[model samples]
Target: MCGTIDLYYALTNKEEAKGILPNLRFVKETNRRDLHDYIMWHNINHLTKFLSKKYEDAYTPVLKVNNRENDNDLIWKKCLKMIPDFLQIPLSSLYLRYNIDPRDKIRVEEMADIIRDTYVKSFRQNAWMDEITKNNSIYKVHDMKFKIGYPQYILDPTEVDKDYEGKMEELPSHICYNQPSMGKRNRAYLFGAIGSIISYFISHSFNHPNREFKRNGVWESWLSNKSLEESFKELQNCYRDQYSKYWINDQQVDGIETIDANIADNSGIFMALQALKNRRDMNNVRYTSNSNITEDQLFFLAYAQARCSNETVTPPPTSPYKYRVNGVVSNLKEFSDAFSCSRGDPMNPPKKCTYWDF
Candidate 1:
């Protein structure tokens, strides 16, 4: 019963989102509100039924009693929910079930190389950092690892099964099958991961030639120079003040709460722009055939389009998509030069936050 319902939700949602599967064609015209309502109803009804059952019986086995794997339906449904591919369902399932065969290996490698070079260049050119720190940063950038697409081991059935087994063992029994607790756990894990990245960058930045960088779990030792410390604090305060004015839940949210994500968003976009600028192919590319827009304009447009979503459904914890686009671009002098935006223009704000040299 639970398998049937789970498959139904997965298939229906995928079809609605992608307009795939001729049998599910009617869902293509379904209103977004109606779709949301249907999902909410489905969750309330089916999830309750599934969760009330004994844990062992809640999810049916992917194989039948005859020791044969259930045909493509179950696997397809699982693929729709688990995989990140945006292609047609069949192709996506094939990719997920097989080896991680990236079709754009050359392109991915090229972008990675550009990003690495840009980062190294930025580190070396940063005026604020000492010579020793700059050298250390360049060494670290050279040592950085890149994991593109999925891991190759996922293609092996035995390895995939073992991975799932390990995950199941690691999960707390009480929260493993509990939807709300599982969501909370996922959020906690995400926060911890992001926190670790931010902490590493901060600690590495402040590391002294005589002292080793240690993760004492507190940010108190992030800066030692009195003037530099004050500048850092001022930079943070700028972010806090700017982001605090943005509305969340019909009220202004405290900027400090969103600082980490904002920093990541800003830094991530800047690095991407740098990579795009460094690409040799982009030298002759234009935004459009007849439009006056430049390649940089198109780059920013692409970034904005990727982030575009229904703002009404966005959570309070997340910044509005407009802010994500505007906030990042506003801090970039490259953006100002590309569009010839004057310093006091809204897109070229005078008091922009510059956390790192980027």
Candidate 2:
């Protein structure tokens, strides 16, 4: 019954599910027990019952895919549990061996300063936020801590080795070949620094008086201004309407579920781009190369590339990779300006859905 239904579904929905076929085939070919076990134990019973009842005549064809057992399957399954420890030991060892540190402390510190400065500037200039809230936001930015790269202690061989003292023999043979470099370290630092700034702002919004809070461990509305509250609702509604248009698996994405990630994606890219622009402006840097693209364009391109993925079979609850790039960039005036996109252009719509004032 399972085989018949599987073949029927694969044949009937082949076009609609084209992107997922390779994954299905890979699973079958590789004989992944974990995936097979999950499907058989959790999903197969319910799924088969539904299909058999719904389409009794659907069992016209049978799947011809070969399913051969691999000798290394047991070893692979065992290794999965130890993967974290296996990877971490070598990674930490490499970091220690090379004495990994922030590639450019001055540059990182400057970027951090720029990000904080930009946040404070946005807070001061925002008309929506009241004086008290804006002041509190600026204070938070000032107090925000920046832990850019690996801690200094990680560079010490003794300290790092102590973490895997008894499990030295468990270190895989692949560990000797793995080495950490400055590029990876720099990228990690950039992500960590940006992530910290973004997280702080997100937490600040929730705790803001404009939203609400608890006075006696019970939730209550602290927003005194009716106009501000209405504006907030309007902004939220705009986001909901905008995001609801996107479909995943034939179902519309819930805007509220995607709000947090959407906010992070949009704000993270914006803040990073702003920092880059600030740095370029301060350094008197101009696009001198004959690449026919400006630094601003490159900035957006880099951001999009970082998030690029073949989101063939993502669940409806999460925003697709393409949407993450498009949805965020479309609302960004800087992106439109950089590319000189027309008002009605897909990437530069005249009307944009915005949740954050910045």
Candidate 3:
């Protein structure tokens, strides 16, 4: 039975993947000399070290807020990121060696497993989403690919280097930004930095725009229940109102502007907590009781610290770091429970707006 259904989806999803194939498909890099031409345009010798080492580092490290006043450094970092598009293979090789490794996948994949399974439970509980959409969401989660670390072919740099012979064969774009999004500093703080941040990002693909795309990457509606759309809108409005009510940098948050992120933030937090809950002894993420923090609370601390920045609050596309931490935790009853907040307290609001609470 499972095999037959898989076959049917494969047949149906081909067209969807095919439609975008023209855009995503890469051609022989040896044939495309524009990249080389672009490189010669720059100070190639001066950038050699940057390209070889520092450029890759800028991308993999935990994101830091731009509090520094060095405009030149920012420009240099910006240039480093752009160069990867031109130096695909060389940079991929460098990235494989230092940024992340195949071994990192085992632990991160375990994290993905915990989050994905928790998402399944959330789907099962969503009464507003019809059976078809919910089931399809679950299916999509099951089928979701974790493009961990780098491409396997890159492991043999000499062999792939010979094959490319100085041209661009773009690896799948999906894997470009997937660094080792987990930290090893503390066990309880496992999700504190990289884990929940990446988990949040992965869940966003299933949120707004990518939500329209199927497990097969097709842009088609699977909302078997028509009212699901309206319900979603209402839920979005709740986020808008909720975030708007908060103040940031002496300016009010335009919930309308940050709605997508807010929605992702909401679901992401829920998923992170649920994922954390699923871990066996939370994988024994280490923390001494001297800190007076529980293992579960440490996860939230890690989650916030990953988003921590030194810059002042900025306007949306994202809420200020403060709101991203407090605004979110305020609505989570689990957060309240984790900290033993009294009802109606600031962090423990009387009313909550969790996505999967239903």
Best candidate according to lDDT? 3
lDDT of 2 by residue, 246-310 (tens): 77678677777766556656666666665565556677765454577666666667567666687
Q: lDDT, candidate 2, residue 293?
A: 68
Alpha carbon deviation, residue 137, candidate 3 (Å): 1.1
Query: In TM-score terms, which candidate is top?
Result: 3
Q: Name model 3 segments beyond 4 Å from true.
A: 1-88, 91-102, 166-169, 172-183, 281-290
In the range 1-358, model 1's lDDT, one tens digit per residue, is 3333443555457554343334354456776787678767666643432242353243346235547442234545855654433322333335555433344333445455666676677877777666655665566556655554445454455654564455423211111111122222222122222222323243233333212331233334333356755655666677778888777557665577666566656766666665555553456553344566555666666566656677732444446666777777788897798788998998898887765564
Q: Candidate 1 at 317: error in angstroms?
A: 5.6
In model 1, the clashing pairs are none
Question: What RMSD does each model have against the real structure?
Answer: 17.1, 13.5, 12.0
Clashes of each: 0, 0, 7
Q: Which pairs of residues collide in candidate 3? A: 29-167, 29-168, 187-285, 187-286, 188-285, 192-302, 192-303
Better of 1 and 2 by TM-score: 2
Instruction: Assess the local accuracy of residue 81 in candidate 2 as a C-alpha lDDT between 0 and 100.
Output: 50
lDDT per residue (tens digit) for residues 1-358 in model 3: 3333333233236675354423432322333475345445443433443563465465333223434232245657877867767666667666766676465666666777777788888888887887898988888888877765556777577856764674535454545445444454554466555566656776787667777887788777556556887887777888888888988567898889998888778777777777766664556544467777887788788778777898667777888878888888888877788889999898887767766743
Task: Give TM per candidate.
Answer: 0.53, 0.60, 0.68
